[model samples]
Target: MTAENNGTGTPPPEGDDDPFAYLYRQEGGAGGSAQQPGVPRRSYAQVRAVGERQYGAQAGPSPQAAPGQQPGSGPGLPPHQPNAHYAAPETMPGGRAAARRQAAAAGGGPGGPRKNRNGLLIGAIAVVAAVIVGIGAAIVFNDDSGKQSQGQSDNNDVPGQDEDKNPKNPKDGDKKPAKDKPKPTGLPSRTDAADATLAGGATKQTEVAKAQSAGGAYVGGMDKPGASVTWTLKDIPESGKYTVFVRYGVPGKDADSTLSVNGKQSDRPLNMSNFAGAKKGDWEAGWAETYSWIDLKEGTNRVQVACGDSNTCDFVLDQFWLKRGWVK
Candidate 1:
């Protein structure tokens, strides 16, 4: 008998309604499609069961492996689990393996990785060598700079050195003024020599009417030709060129004489005539002065004043003076 609407198996109301619509319809908000409009479809629970058994719990099936083929277990590759976290180095197939094989073919053998490591090491060594060379060059350059600076400093000090060695070089136009030289001074001591005697004709000791000196005495009457007055100085402490100053009196006329010390004639003769005209008076009343110089020997000395060629000495000799040095 045919199942009717009232029986356990019932026919749906049919007015252009699909007989298999319920089979393809959504179940518990999950959707599935059928091969044909009238064909039945599997349920969501059944589809989920099939997927779990075919693939892993969380991962989809890899396209590289066929339906029955294992993952990462291709021919000429190592055996590996399909659900493992990572594949072995030898089992890393497909594009990565193909790339590694290509690299190995280009590089010679399995030693390609080692060669790459060696190349990296060589590159690092080259970088280090370059850095060291750069540092060495910098040090050399700094040394040269220091030497140049020292040379410059030495050059700068050269002028001062030269100035120190020769403080007054004529070539230096702009020079500081030189200090003045010291003036010449007179002799340190004097020797009084008033005692003398007549050495030749017409020369004798005379006394003045009025005292003008300590002894008030002199050598007089020197009017004869070849007459001379002599003095023998003793105990002379020094031997050097000495000055001889003569104090004398003039009576309105001039006198001429020459001096000799130790038998050596003076360089120049003396003229006592110039002293008499400066003052007009008697011979013994006014005194005048004249001087000459000669070298005196040590211990004792002999000085003689002789009349000139005119054969007459009119002046009266009063005293003698012996100084250490002569005037320039």
Candidate 2:
């Protein structure tokens, strides 16, 4: 009965209203009907065995059941017809086989090959480390090369380091001769005043103490006019200015005398001041020195200490000395 008949015991037209007509249509068989209008069809046996196909095996030909016999049933059982409404769970959408295929694609099922995640991770890390090491080595090599170049440049720029490049000459190594130093002037010449020629009642005496002359004698009695002591010095080294240092003792008062060099009177008188700071009339403690600059000849030069008309002569002469230069 067709769907439109609604169990009225009337069959619909051969192919127009039969819902299961595609299941019964046959090709290249005896008593086969015309082609159906809907999808092309397979036999009932083929449709029933589709769910039974193995996952990896190819489908062979299905065995046709004998008439009035059940598929896979022994002879004691009754014959069973194919149910057109029957559907296998594996053949439906979202079935177990499709779920298993999804599981395998997601790498969770037993059929899927697992990948070594740790090995991939470790290999990536090793490649990155190798790259970093190569970069570091290049940097080190460049730094060392730069330092060596700088060191070489510094060595080349320095002077007096490469002996082979700039050899030393013997004349350049020899030192210059030192200039000759002038000979030192002769030492001072000391003459005792007592040994000098005395005139005009200027006599030599040993009465005063602390006289630096020989035998502690000194020239005395030079207080009057025309009294004088003359010294004739000889063997002067050069014709230059000389210092005439006179050692004299006073009665603790300042006195001075006229000085003449080589028979020419000096412009200024010899100063015989009482530098000792002694009490008046203390001749022993009044011993002091005086000097005068005079121009003399290289040979013998006569020096005179006289009591002139304008002189205040109250000093006793002890010693007269000649220094090469004018000094106090």
Candidate 3:
């Protein structure tokens, strides 16, 4: 009813120029929305059809160059070395040709040769890729290890943790009570005080036999001039240096004091071993550093505590301190 004249009518023929020509000439990427004039508007079916034609053409043999010209002389191919051993097949076969076909069928000609070449190329490529991956993995692992070490260090430095594991940590806890330092043999913890009192008010003070006082108290000398006292020293546990604490008291005039162990002047400054500079005195504090690897004799040893004037530092002869080992 809509087309009253349609029953016997025919449509006009389409134009002759290639309607698909626009599909082949574009240079842009495949997925963008930007439009270009002159480019064919493509439906999915049209695009797929054009693509098949192009792919088939490329996959087939390319056009040959002019007769007598080399394969790579045109823009179509890169420069190449002619394969001297490869020759085009002839239409007519000679005895050599027959033999080559037979060899190929037997796995010694075209098939075997091509197969070997492909396998070698693949193996070489795989080895190179494996080496590259190994190097990359090693570098990554080393970086991760370094990060782990840094993390451990950060953990150790976290607040509220025991710094005993820290290299810069300080000493802590109750120090093991000092061991008795070596003292001059044949003397009690107290031996002098000739009218002076003992340090710390501990009544364990007493005089030694005058005979023991000036005796040959050494495998060396007068273990030093003094009333021998119970000398406590740190245990020589390991190799290192330690500090020894001592206290002394006595009376004298304008007298400075000196402390020594076993005939030798102790190797530490003692400018404050006494405050006797003002007269009638009480105990004064002192300290010393003893090197390890030194054997401390048990029991009493003469620790000459002398109190003297500028002309002499006197020996209070009756004071000693508890000792302990501190390592550095």
Candidate 4:
């Protein structure tokens, strides 16, 4: 074998060899210096063992020196030995043990103590409960407002409650009560044709049968223009609208007369149609009824039926009457 090969024939370095020796040489370390020309390099096994060394073990006996050399003398430096004060990370103060303790204090590490969760859970529950209470309060408030508003609406819908609570002024005693207005009693007040005043050739006649007037009397001679019969009504209960019903007879055809109330002429002539369906000149069978609306005073009023220039007044008046209100 060649002396440079050391009888190993250039085998690959072992796994435990220092791969970073070149970086140590660049930084000019004494341990990384170039070897002397004749000194042999040490093998990795002679340099340092791979496993941990026992720092506190008893020392073994030293090897005998060469015959002429000293006991500690060698051709090159001695093999690397572990320092006497070196310690493992697990055994040193403030190392792996301290780091594990710090991790446990800061909460759970990989498998250390677990953090507290009850506080967060309670806070979330309290928030939900508060929300529920707020919703309940809102519902109650809305219900109360709705009930109050409904009560006010009900009060407004009651009829005449305000009027009953507030009476009329005592100073207006002369005014009639609102409920005292006249209503129809279904009984009409009657005036016979004999009791009416006649003018312009109008005269009372008893010849017609079934007149409905006292003694079968009626007013006649109303065919001439300007002839009229006037009735002065009295003892009216109140001043209001009234209907004047007249009972009259015709000669079988239709006839009409002008009607005036309280001396004011009516806008339209009074209708005296042949409602009885009698033959011509059959005055007794031609008895029929007609009505006109008029306003009357509280105590007295006058109603007149006349033969105007435009009237066909062949009909005779038998009776006149008053109903309380304007009616058909």
Candidate 5:
């Protein structure tokens, strides 16, 4: 018989006479219609299998079942595979093991694929941070080195200033200090005959007190015609005419002597006509002779006296005087 829904939405109970009565009963209902006589009844397991094939797979009792699990196998459900389009939870945040540990810590059980993706993102952030830090460190190091080099350059500049201000010790590039120039001796100067440069027959010997010379010495023995005497004058104050006074004596007649200044001879030989005879030995009677003004150069000069060609024209030379003013 067909079952009718009571006013309370409940079906009537099945009759004791029909063994298939329970098959037509609604789940959790009081009763239902009996199965038809021509059709066979299906078991609970067969009915569930047909339902799974028609609709999508539903959640099983436990989530720990391995893949390809047969129905009715123990308590666990079949292994779950997430959609291929989504990134696996294991490859998201951390490695598979670490992700599993995190999931376990969060009470997510295990085998979470989203955690692995998070791990990849964290690793990327760490790498970017490291690169940034390295670049910053390199920039700082370069700046420090540049500052050191500039400081060294500044230090080098200090020495240059010192070299310019203090000239006692000079550096390689510093200019040398100027040397002091010699000053002129304004007063009259004299040279003794003994100090003269003698050549040929001229010689230095002791002379008597009457000799017109100091230092107890004079240049004598200049009897040969080729004998000569030279005196070096230095530190001349100015270039002008100077009078040369000679102290000399001739044992015989007056003599004629040649005078050369700076290798240039005088225009005329100096005539020695005012000779006084010697008392005893040669040049015992000394006489002072004055010459006309001669040109004197400023600085070192050579004054030379040579005997005339005749041997009798030679005389004893004691000393000479160079005065700035002319002789009256």
Candidate 6:
């Protein structure tokens, strides 16, 4: 029965603001009649069948083009597939999915399967979000790594000179024997030696004292009962400490030993004798040392020591590492 005769009819004026929209939804929207708001004069059997399968096998056209053709080809390259995996991208510039989606929903053309539209929306959003998050994390890590690398580079930098070259005192290698410095600052009062140790910047200080020896090497000390003036240091600094080093060998053999300073003792015993060395003609045994840190109240402190242990070997006092500060 026509709604008009039933008293529930809508106003029949063309001015009805929203008539077609209401009718369109009710008809699944493929068509409408001129006489009635939603009446379609024709019955669409196939269209109805396709629409009924909107969420199932009806999602897209059967993977064929005409009665007998392959899916990805017709004549030239089968135009790029519309990335149909997800809800077609929002308003993709090519206006492709909208018509199909509508036609399928309305049983008009190749209708899509009646799949859960909600799940597809969620999945598409998830993929896009994952890509964005991945890109963001990479950018942050890269920036942090760059800063760390810059810090390490700064630490490895050399300050004043060529990092590759070994450091050396400038006076080294000069031909002229460097004028002997007048001993250390207070060495004169300690013992009288022509030049026991270099005061200025000379690199090496050698033993120039006269001592007891049977062979080419000399060995002497306060070990027995005699006074042995091996080498006299000049003006030894009261603030700095002194280190005694020597090389020695036992009678006819090498022996280990250490030098005593002002009655001081070695943490370990000496290892040598004067003329008695490791090799017959070789006098190659000595220690590189620094003196124990000591503070002397006055200048020209008296310094004394003897060399020898079991065999009292011959020894040569080599170098002294001296610096200004008393606090070592």
Clash count for each candidate, listed in order shown: 0, 0, 24, 0, 16, 38
What lDDT is obtained when candidate 6 is compared to the true structure?
0.40
Predictions in order: lDDT: 0.59, 0.76, 0.40, 0.73, 0.65, 0.40
Which candidate number has the best TM-score?
A: 5
- The segments of candidate 4 whose C-alpha lies over 4 angstroms from its true place after superposition are 1-188
Q: For residues 1-328, could you state the per-residue lDDT of candidate 3 as single tens digits?
A: 1211111122213442344433433323434333243443343232232112321233443334444554345556445423333333442256678768878988889868789999999999999999999999999999999999988887766576655664443476546578986644332332222322323322332332221222312111111333233343433333323333333333333323345555566544344333434344322322121222122345333344443222243333432333334533
| True lDDT of residue 140, candidate 2 | 100
Candidate 1 lDDT by residue in tens digits, 46-110:
33211222223355533243334443456643443343343334545565677677678888547
lDDT of 3 at 168: 46
TM-score for candidate 3: 0.21
The TM-score obtained by model 4 is 0.43
Best first by TM-score, ranked? 5, 2, 4, 1, 6, 3
- Candidate 4 — what's its lDDT? 0.73
Looking at candidate 1, the ten consecutive residues that score lowest on lDDT are 1-10
Q: By the TM-score metric, which is better: model 5 or model 6? A: 5
Per-residue lDDT over 125-238 for candidate 6, one digit per residue giving the tens place of the 0 to 100 score: 999999999999999999999999988876685788656546666678647557975534433322222124322222222243322232232322323422223344435555
Over 1-328, each residue of candidate 5 has an lDDT whose tens digit, in order, gives: 5433321246555553443543543333234334334333333222433212212335453222233444334354333333233445555667687766776788675434457777888999999999999999999999999999988876675644564534465455768678878677673467788888999788887754566456678787777787889988878888888887777776645666888899998888876754565443454553647575688888888888888674355577877878766774
Q: What C-alpha RMSD separates each model from the true structure?
A: 18.3, 21.3, 27.3, 18.1, 17.5, 29.3
Give residue 324's lDDT in candidate 3 (0 to 100).
36
Model 5 residue 39 CA deviation in Å:
25
